[model samples]
Target: MNFNFLDKLSPEYRNYKIERIKNGASKKLFFKISKGSDSFVCTDFNSDKLEYKNHLVVHRILSNIDISIPTLIEKNDDKLIIVSEDFGNLRYDKILKQQSIKDLLQYATDTLCIINKEINFNPTYTLPQYNIELFKNEIAELPQYYFSYNNIIDRIDSLNDEFFDIWIESFKQLNFNFKHFVHKDFNMNNLIFLPSREGHLKCGVIDYQNSFWGESSWDLFSLLEDSRIFFTDQYNAYFMNYFYSHSNQLISLKEFKLKYHLLNCSRQTRLLGRWVKLANELNQPWYLDFISTTKLRLQSSLAILQNNKLTKFYDKYIL
Candidate 1:
């Protein structure tokens, strides 16, 4: 929120007017600086400089693979500030609201599939693998924030263990590991459509600093279950079918469907806790708005997985 840090960077930007871009959860600071119509986005990370370095590595990989992403302009390492190309205010969700949702989402879906098929994890570059403990901790927050206070921590922990157990079994059954590179936050909100570009290059990506080698289903789960976008049953089914058909088919169709539902439950579980944390810790009601939608998504996913016990547990607190 301070511009004094810019004084040491360049005399040209010292007189620039700063405007905050309130797009995401507000964990980090994003600003749009315009000095006589030439604008760029500056992200002030509340995290360490290593995250900035990760961004640089992943950004370059995505760029080399022909994925459309904002260009990095400059980096102020001492301040941990990253300046990158501004893709303007356009997001895939805003464009979807204009006309048919199915047509619009298909573009992003196909583009994402292309990215996954082409971008393999490079052993030489050393991208971190999103492992089990990290994933379990992500899911563990659900009870820690929402149900831990009512003497049900044990019950919640039991259910958490069940969730992990289910995924471990699925991992064995499908014979798949988390080797695919995933844009951890891949969704309509993080994508911008560039009509000037052709093919997969048409989709411009941002906010990919959290990317890691993770489950093949993780990013797709995030895409379809995005709380910010309304994916109708028809749109959802169409996209799911397209994904399965176009996928590398490393896993069977039936098993891939199972993985999809499991991943959905996993993500919605994390989001339920995230919403509670946002409201209780940060006093942000905006996240709480997704409660009902997230509940519905969890129920639908649980129905597919046929886990009535965990479904009942989730309903006990959330429904």
Candidate 2:
């Protein structure tokens, strides 16, 4: 809350007026700094957090590969503030209400295709793989936050173990090997619509510091099957088929659908728990609004997979 360090960036900004941007569930802070009609975004974060560093590195990587992203204008390492181009308020979630689903999805699908095709790891810096252990840790959020907060389950320790085992076995069935770069949070909320740009460049990606090496279907499902938004089965199938046709990933549609549903099940489960934690611990109760939608999506994924143990687990506890 103390922004005294802004003076280090410019003496003129010492008494400047700014607008706080609602950054969603992230701990980081975003503000729009305006000087007359011109404006820039300032991302304020804890200097000690690893995500702050990752943001800079990933920005360089994505920008180099022609992934549409905000242009970095300045960085003050001491204050942990990054100044970048402001894309205004055209976030995909907001724009979707005004635009056709086909056009919007085409732009988003094309961007995801580019991200999968171009991103790769180098020896100098390594990204974490979306391995089984990582998946377990992510899904742990459900038991720790949601169940405990709601007092829905007794003897959560044992039940939590059973739940994890189900997911572990389910993951094994898919036989996914970490292959493509995953923007772990690839939902519409994190994408911006840049109208002036054409093709895939029209979609500006952000908040991807948590990028990882994961199955190709991970990001695709994250976008199409987003828990926060509801797309009809028709829309989901059309866009997914569009991505498969264009991305040229080696996996067939049959295999991709299997992996997509499995990974999305994990993601939705994590959000179900995480939204509760955000409300309780962070005092951000707005997140609770998404819980019902997230739960519905989780059920949909479970229905598609037809995993008896997983379905039973949900029925006994979560339902």
Candidate 3:
């Protein structure tokens, strides 16, 4: 777990003290490097499966476009470690508690709209595409943790069948532009609030390198339907209205809601399995704490979407 390659690469960090940050679900490890008054976050991606380079590329693109992304200070390609400007431990949720949830949602909504407005579609960022099949495959893991593991589904095969069937029907509804910067992990925890900066830069974004090619609404839902915090009805309404109006009717509210609900269900369901995987495989039991809230959010979306396929599956296990 010693990721001192940053110190070896840069003499300034030779005296840096490394402290681990334990908030992420990914297998990659994060460390805080402290050298008296100077500080930077170092990420260690031990897994070759995860393309850490994508985040670095995104940092380059977003930084040039005026987005407040962490500035990449140093990186060692062979070590799979990256050192970037530390935004500190300030999270959007912490600000939400001190300020106003509704107010923060509006600011956050404005940030999302900026991505839609400013970031180009196929601007040669060269990131991966989040196609429908990739979306379906991610949702397919839900049955194991949400239904079968919970004893809601009787058979593994049946669980897989229901999981794919519901998602396939839901995926058909998305006639996305597939030409926007989609921050796949946009949420309170990953967002950093900086009061001193102006406009969207006031909100420094982290964990945004996991972005992809898709309709911008994918991120809007990721922000509003976040499972970490139970957003009030007012917060939800304000966010939807603000984004719809701000984007100049980019997508119809009706169609956006349809995509929003189903995408949230897909995301929440995928997260349920992700939490279980972290707890069981990674021995990170703290992930279990978020399961109930995530499940409730998933259920809420499923209830409203009213897909008979998912509705039947839900009643069988979740009810």
Best by TM-score: 2
Q: Whole-model lDDT for model 1 versus the true structure?
A: 0.73
Decoy 1 TM-score against native = 0.87
Better of 2 and 3 by TM-score: 2
Q: Candidate 3: where is the Cα deviation over 4 Å?
A: 1-3, 153-156, 248-250
Q: If scored against the real structure, what TM-score would every candidate get?
A: 0.87, 0.92, 0.89
* Backbone clash numbers for all candidates listed: 0, 0, 0
Give the better candidate number (1 or 2) by lDDT: 2
Residue pairs clashing in model 2 are: none
Q: For each candidate, what is the lDDT?
A: 0.73, 0.80, 0.75
Of the candidates shown, which would achieve the greatest lDDT relative to the real structure?
2
Cα RMSD for candidate 3? 2.5
Model 1 deviation from the true structure expressed as Cα RMSD, one decimal place? 2.8
Model 1 clashing residue pairs (backbone) = none
